[model samples]
Target: MKIFSNPNISKVMKIYEKSKKHTSEGVKETDYSKDKLELSNNAKELQIALKAYKNLPEIREEKVKEIKDRIQQGSYNVAGKEIAEKILQGVQIDKKI
Candidate 1:
């Protein structure tokens, strides 16, 4: 039941002792008195835009009602070519990722 006799345990103990010695000798203390953060012009603009977007409604009810009316009037059409092109674009984007 002697664990130190194992080669792996001996190697681990040697590494731990080396790390302990390295850490104990002349380590300087870090200062945590003051913290500062400054945002760039572009970052500030982005934050403002994000805040405006968050204030907007999640769903545009007017647009949804208009589309619903178009469908009821039998005028709402989906182009196959456009759908195919979008599918191809999505596949290409997925491959890039």
Candidate 2:
């Protein structure tokens, strides 16, 4: 094995040593405290909205009772055009998905 005395190798070694010293000197001991979480105004509002939505009834009893009453009284009337439009709207939504 043979080692050559190159000026470039010496220059690189010097730079590496300088950087090593700087790295060691620049580091300091760090003290970490407890982690904290904070929500923004929008996030707080969204949480409140979500809570409210969760609390809401899945089925509206009053509306259902009114519809049932109308149906029993034979007063419930639905237009064919309205039903067809709703069907077409459902088809459009399905196509989009």
Assess the local accuracy of residue 3 in candidate 1 as a C-alpha lDDT between 0 and 100: 100
1-97 in candidate 1: lDDT tens per residue? Answer: 9999999999999999999987876364544578889999999999999999999999999999999999999999989999999999999999999
**For residues 1-97, what per-residue lDDT tens digits would candidate 2 score against the true structure?**
2343777777988999999988887775545689999989999999999999999999999999999999999999999999999999999999999
Q: How high a TM-score does candidate 2 get?
A: 0.53
Reference-based TM-score of each model: 0.54, 0.53
Worst 10 residues of 2 by lDDT: 1-10
Deviation in Å, model 1, residue 24 alpha carbon: 18
The best candidate by TM-score is 1
* Candidate 1 lDDT (Cα, 0 to 1): 0.93
lDDT of each: 0.93, 0.91
The residue pairs found clashing in candidate 1 are none
